[model samples]
Target: MAIDVRIPTILRSYTGGSKAVSGTGDTLADLLTNLDGAHPGLRGRLVTPEGGLHRFVNIYVNDEDVRFLGSLEAKLNDGDTVTILPAVAGGALGFAAAHALRG
Candidate 1:
């Protein structure tokens, strides 16, 4: 299946600065492999050495979190949109904002 993947800003270098790329696969893993083929070193940042999705990375299939849909095994279809995002934690004002919200 042909899929459109949305690449995160940090990983855009692998894609020649393109924020989106096209790949073909039946599952998310295959799609990523295909992407890596065209954009070398891209998959290594998303998948771990154990062949699993990286802990700090998040993937979504058609707007639904892949973690809730079989993760890397999540099935794909033509025209499906795959989104990759790195899990972000505290920001510049995170601590203060969190404390303010807690009060």
Candidate 2:
């Protein structure tokens, strides 16, 4: 199955600055492998050493979160659009709330 992967700005370097790239696979994991073959070093940033997805990154298949869809085992179809987004840190507000609650 041919899939369209939307690359985030930070990871665009792997695709030679391309915002979107195409790959093929039956599952999300296969798609990543296909992408890595064409764009070396890209998979490492999204997947962990144990072969699971990295917590810092979020992936969605056609607007649905892959995590809720069996993660790496998520099924994909041809022409599906895969979106990769880096998790936004809560930063200051989160830190302040945690500190206040601790007190």
**TM-scores for every predicted model:** 0.85, 0.87
Per-residue CA lDDT of model 1 for 1-103, tens digit only, reads 6799999999999999999999999999899899989999999999999999997898999989999999999999999999999998667677667889999
Clashes of each: 0, 0
- Residue by residue across 1-103, what tens digits does model 2's lDDT show? 6899999999999999999999999999999999999999999999999999987799999989999999999999999999999998777567668879999
Residue pairs of candidate 2 with colliding backbone atoms: none
Q: Give candidate 2 misplaced runs (Cα > 4 Å).
A: 92-103
Model 1 clash number: 0
Q: List the residue pairs that clash in candidate 1.
A: none
